[model samples]
Target: MNHNLLLDSIAKHIHLDEEETALFLSFIQPKKVRKKQYLLLEGEVNRFGMFVTSGCLRSYNLDENGFQYIQQFAPEGWWMGDMYSLITQEPGHLYIDALFDSELLLISKTNLERLYKEVPKFNYYFRILAEKSLVSYQTRAMENLRLTAKERYEKFCLRYPTLVDCLSQKQVAAYIGVTPEFLSKMLHSEPELKP
Candidate 1:
């Protein structure tokens, strides 16, 4: 495994000693999620909080009508998991799956807590990460309520430029809460809007 990118990733938030870093890195297992694979299923505990190294993932909810509503997308450098399920050991309301073949780093709850004990300030690091998650989802909801469909699609595309290359059109439409056909038209016809 290339330890540089992973170390650089963690160092951006908090520097770890060689020992602590080694222990932390030992806990992060690299895995590949095949295309159309489910990392998490609804009604199951989230065993690992995943970090994307490449490719993309989506978290969605299936309704009684069997319609899937996409909640969030995770691309490279993003974190994806059912935070509630991982924290509480309760069944998750969401299903997390890969949009394409993915290179992921998996960290379990046990090791994360172990890091908190070992590294002292690791809890603070995770807290900040969680806060970002909260704010991002909150902002996304706000944007959905406040912006037009075209506006929301534009914002999503701008925010994740490599997304189209990494994810399918179906997944992109799911992220923006639009049909694939609509996303296609919007992509071609709509003028760009500044964020």
Candidate 2:
């Protein structure tokens, strides 16, 4: 993965001087994970906020019944982390794994704090990010309560068209809160949306 991708991503959100950018890059530790490999597991502290440079990852939790509920999928240029665990330094409920062989840039909580102190603009950027994340979480929760399964599937497609093909139908169904068979029926009924 090109370092420029990380540089470009930061530049899009906030202006960074050369020195600031260098400092930012210095703290980044690049990691590669093969498909089905975990970057983090349940009961582990989420030490790093990860940026996907290539491929995809999913953050999910398994219920008592062993059913997986996916909270988020991070594709190229996206960030993924357990905010609660990162903030509290406690074990997280989610398991984060690569869906495909992936390259990532990780910034540990300690390094992130250092960055926030050294480059105060970074605090503003992260605050904006947190606000957007909260909005998305609230919207998802509302949709789960208010929308029908078919409606949720449609909205999921509209919002994450790339992921529709990138992920398995089963994974998509899990994310949208429906059984695979039900999602199949819904997709079949809407032939235009079926892949």
Best by lDDT: 2
Show pairs that collide, candidate 1: none
Query: Worst lDDT window (10 residues) for model 2?
Result: 1-10
Candidate 2: stretches off by over 4 Å? none
lDDT (Cα, tens digit) per residue for candidate 1, span 3-113: 566677678888788888888888889888898899989999998988888888889988797767788788777788998899898988999998788898888988877
Q: How many backbone clashes does candidate 1 have?
A: 0
lDDT of 2 by residue, 1-195 (tens): 478887887777899988998899899999999999998899999999999999999999899998899999999989999888999999999999999999999999999999999999998888888999999999999989999988888899899999998788999999998889988898888897775
Candidate 1, poorest ten consecutive residues by summed lDDT? 186-195
TM-scores for all predictions:
0.87, 0.96
- Among residues 3 or more apart in sequence or in different chains, the pairs in candidate 2 whose N, CA or C atoms overlap within 3 Å are none
